[model samples]
Target: MKYDGGAQNVLSEDYYNLVIDQSGNKTAQGVINVANDMTISNSASFLTSTNTIDVSEQQRWRNLNW
Candidate 1:
């Protein structure tokens, strides 16, 4: 995943999770973004090659009025 904008305005909490299975047969990716809040929970058990998780970038907006 990639964001090309100048910044990412996340109003509240954000979370993500990823899972991969052995033999490189299964994989999963999850993302949670909310205007006010966000939450994510995940679990997995496996082993494989090229099974990696990465976060490109993150940015928050400033309260212009405050």
Candidate 2:
């Protein structure tokens, strides 16, 4: 999954499991309470992309995951 724009794009959500693999799959490390928006790319299994999702993470609304 990637955004249609470049730096103009932003991470709108921060509380869901995502897939970061070769087969384009969805991963899960359980539910984690996100305090702020951030890019979490790890090998332990956890999260996507767009306009090349290489973009940074940023939150917009609040308590959307709660």
Instruction: Give me the candidate number with maximum lDDT.
Output: 2
In order, what lDDT does every prediction score? Answer: 0.26, 0.30
TM-score of each: 0.17, 0.21
Which tens-of-lDDT digit does each residue in 1-66 have in candidate 1?
Answer: 222122222222243422121222222233333233211212222222443323334633222222
Tens digit per residue, CA lDDT, model 2, 8-65: 2224445443223222224332333344442323222224232222222554222122
Candidate closest to the true structure, highest TM-score:
2
Q: Which lDDT value does model 1 have at 60?
A: 35
> Candidate 1 — which residues are off by over 4 angstroms?
1-15, 27-54, 58-66
Stretches off by above 4 angstroms in model 2 are: 1-23, 38-66
For model 1, name the residue pairs that clash: none
Poorest 10 consecutive residues by lDDT, candidate 1: 37-46
